[model samples]
Target: MTVLYRRVLGAALDDLPPQLLALHDSADPRTWSGQARIWRGAGILSRLIGWVMRLPPQGDAVPVSVSFIPQDGGEVWQRDFAGHTFMSYQYQAPNAQPGIVNERFGMIDVTVAFQTDRDRLVLEPMAWAFGPLPLPKALLPTGQSFETQIDDRFVFDVEIAMPWVGQIATYRGWLLPTE
Candidate 1:
């Protein structure tokens, strides 16, 4: 009774999170947990609805266009770039279990930066909110602003703003060329 969680981004179907797959394995109609049951139900619905009206997942990675509006009322830098960017929202409730720790939780912000250099236009980020500030002066030889190069593959750098976790948390990954 194992269930494999799967997701398809664009035309490529990808595996789901390990936690999600585990939930499917342990799901039982007679003894199903609250949250796990909900997830199973939603997945079933997704399959049924998908047959009637197939819709694409909005979170898929795609080449997106961005217009750089003046943050300080400067000039606009609008250009077409092969990249994907995303943001997220989450909600949490206080723990009210007997004798358990109770706490108040608020909003969280996650910003992701991704780039695929199809056209190979080198773009540098001036202001970044999610990661450590100042690009670790050691990495830059000039001790000035950091520079990024566009290549054949996409690179992802993420900054998660969850005061609950930490003031600032960053994660970076690159899709290296396999071919």
Candidate 2:
């Protein structure tokens, strides 16, 4: 599932438009916070009636863990680390109703990285709940053997080369948007 996710995300980024690509390139700017969106998905919906009755709010330092599977189907798995966020605005269902609902609020990032290889990359928290901020480069890994990115228009793309898989592979038209 992780491998499939990486491949799907990578394909999305590869198909972004030139203008959107520029937005993503300028993403690491001082005003970078405004360049991306933050998103938090939680809470359970009522099965009989579609509504968010109870919600699970995230804590100050939530653990974002990563696990890597060897390409050759080896038992030796490589694992990375954890990431944390303090208070992100919660997106809740309105009035606990099926059709009737209040609007939701959340943020998103132009590009989000979950580097499984600790030797490759690490993300250091900057700011949260207030506005988007630039992710420090020091926290990022040196080599780019595997990674992912999303464009300004919310178009995502990713690339991965594991020991098991020689290179990236997928069905054609993998990144095209469908209505």
lDDT of 1 by residue, 29-80 (tens): 2111110000111244433432232221223233333232322212122322
Q: Once model 1 is optimally superposed onto the true structure by TM-score, how far is the C-alpha of residue 51 displaced, in angstroms? A: 28
Segments in model 2 whose C-alpha atoms lie over 4 Å from true places:
1-19, 24-152, 165-179
lDDT of 2: 0.24
RMSD of 1: 23.0
Instruction: Extract clashing residue pairs from model 1.
Output: none
How close is every model to the real structure, measured as TM-score? 0.20, 0.17
In candidate 1, residue 71 scores what lDDT?
A: 21
Query: Which candidate gets the maximum TM-score versus the true structure?
Result: 1
How does candidate 1 fare on TM-score?
Answer: 0.20
